[model samples]
Target: MSRLVQRITASIRFTPACVFPLLIGGSAIAVFLAVFLLPVYAKNNSLDRAIQDRREALERQELFAPIHARLTMQLREASSLVVGDRQDIQDTPKSPEEAVYKLSLLAEQAHRLGLLGVTPHPDSLSTQDNLAAELRLAGPFPQLRDLLITLLAQPWLHRLERLEISGGADVEEFRVGVSVRMDEGS
Candidate 1:
């Protein structure tokens, strides 16, 4: 094997023929890399960019996960507590006449619940398509609480926007503001 190695090394020389073949082989390798390996590298880089984009999207979703969860829970709780006739909201008021009738009916209901001096802001309905009403009530604290509970349970999707309760032991003076969407469009 040593003799063969020596003979092989001695037979090879940097002649024109030997140098010519080496140059051709090196050129062929260069051509192969330019034709195939370069495009493969570009495609690999594109895939890495796509993976980075997906990772950024996943990070954003994770960041908002708690807010999404809280909103879902609140919606579920509100849906579960509805205890009024849904039909009351089927007719969206198209004119002042209809709006007045609805307000009167609502006031009557409030009167029955020991609430008085009910007034609705018509401008609120025209401007924002929301039925905003204010009421004054002098009653026991338990009655005031019951009214608030009933308002929340109404199927019209009404919410108490603001409330002020001032009283001691016997009589409570309550000032309340409530609002509901006029219809699906509003």
Candidate 2:
């Protein structure tokens, strides 16, 4: 063991000629790694994180896509049903009694349009000077549609307050309510 140590130490000399070159080479290699390899690794890591974040955002958008589409379609339907503010009805009722007369006229029109189970219930006046009435009817879809169009086309300022549709496949029952605003005089 003593002789082996002697031989090894003798072969590996700490001479300046060998030591300087080894030290310079190690330092150069370290500088090369710092200047080139480390920056490349850091940039690759940042790019991978950016890609992961974008994928998560895309996944979230995909999850809510159906809900967004449904809400958009509902908004379109509601907008089509809305009455614009600038439109003026020529012969609005001046009193609740006149409003009831108008409602009776609407019931007669509904009957003529072949709507069954036509029942109109006039409600008392609300605090907002609005006279409300509910018309319950059962009919085919076409007659119901025509009645709705006719109601919209009437020469009075009214709103379709509540609409409830029920029944089976062939026939539909509708409980429709209208609110007519009476002028302040009566």
Candidate 3:
């Protein structure tokens, strides 16, 4: 053999075992990092991002605190109006027949406010203390706008779930459905 080959063979034969073991150990560490440690690191990063998103949502809710407080106060005041002034609402119809009478009175009141024609329909009586009514009104555009403003300004809680307005030959007419829920305890 050449001098270089003889030296290489002698080094491999003597210090040999440690070189092979080191190579294998380095490869095992690389495989473990690729297959196990890398994925765990990626998962931790994703979890951190999710936590950040939740913190931002909580901060947004805190920013709306004043608006939420004001709305809650308005709702409480409206509810009290219905229950507190019992005398004013004492004549409100209790029976189905009487309810229809009261509805007519409300419709007439609407008509006087420049609404051309007003009609109110009450559904069948339920065991619950809730009352639901549908009101249909027809008139000029300006008058219809005014009527809606007045209805919304009422002290009682009235939810206008749906409103349909159509243009007619001489005027615009509106069909509105209003629902009122009264607690039995009230």
- Backbone clashes for every candidate come to 0, 0, 0
Residue-level error in angstroms, candidate 3, position 112: 6.1
Candidate 2 backbone collisions, by pair: none
* Candidate 1 lDDT score relative to the true structure: 0.66
lDDT of each: 0.66, 0.68, 0.59
Tell me the tens digit of each residue's lDDT in model 2 across 1-186. 999999999999788999999999999999999999999999999999999999999999999999977975564445435523423222678876677676556555654343444333444554446777777777677766656655665545356778898988777788878877777765
Report the C-alpha displacement of residue 153, candidate 2, in angstroms: 2.3
Worst 10 residues of 3 by lDDT: 85-94
Candidate 3's error at 56, in angstroms? Answer: 17
What global local distance difference test value does model 3 have?
A: 0.59
> How do the residues 63-165 of candidate 3 rate in per-residue lDDT, one tens digit apiece?
9988977885676566455436442242434444444455444545554333343333434256445456666667766655545544444433346557898
Which residue pairs does candidate 3 place in steric collision?
none
TM-score of each: 0.44, 0.42, 0.41
Error of 1 at 75 (Å): 8.6
Question: Tens-digit lDDT track for model 1 on 97-148?
Answer: 4544664454445433455676777677565456777777777776566456
lDDT of 2 at 153: 54
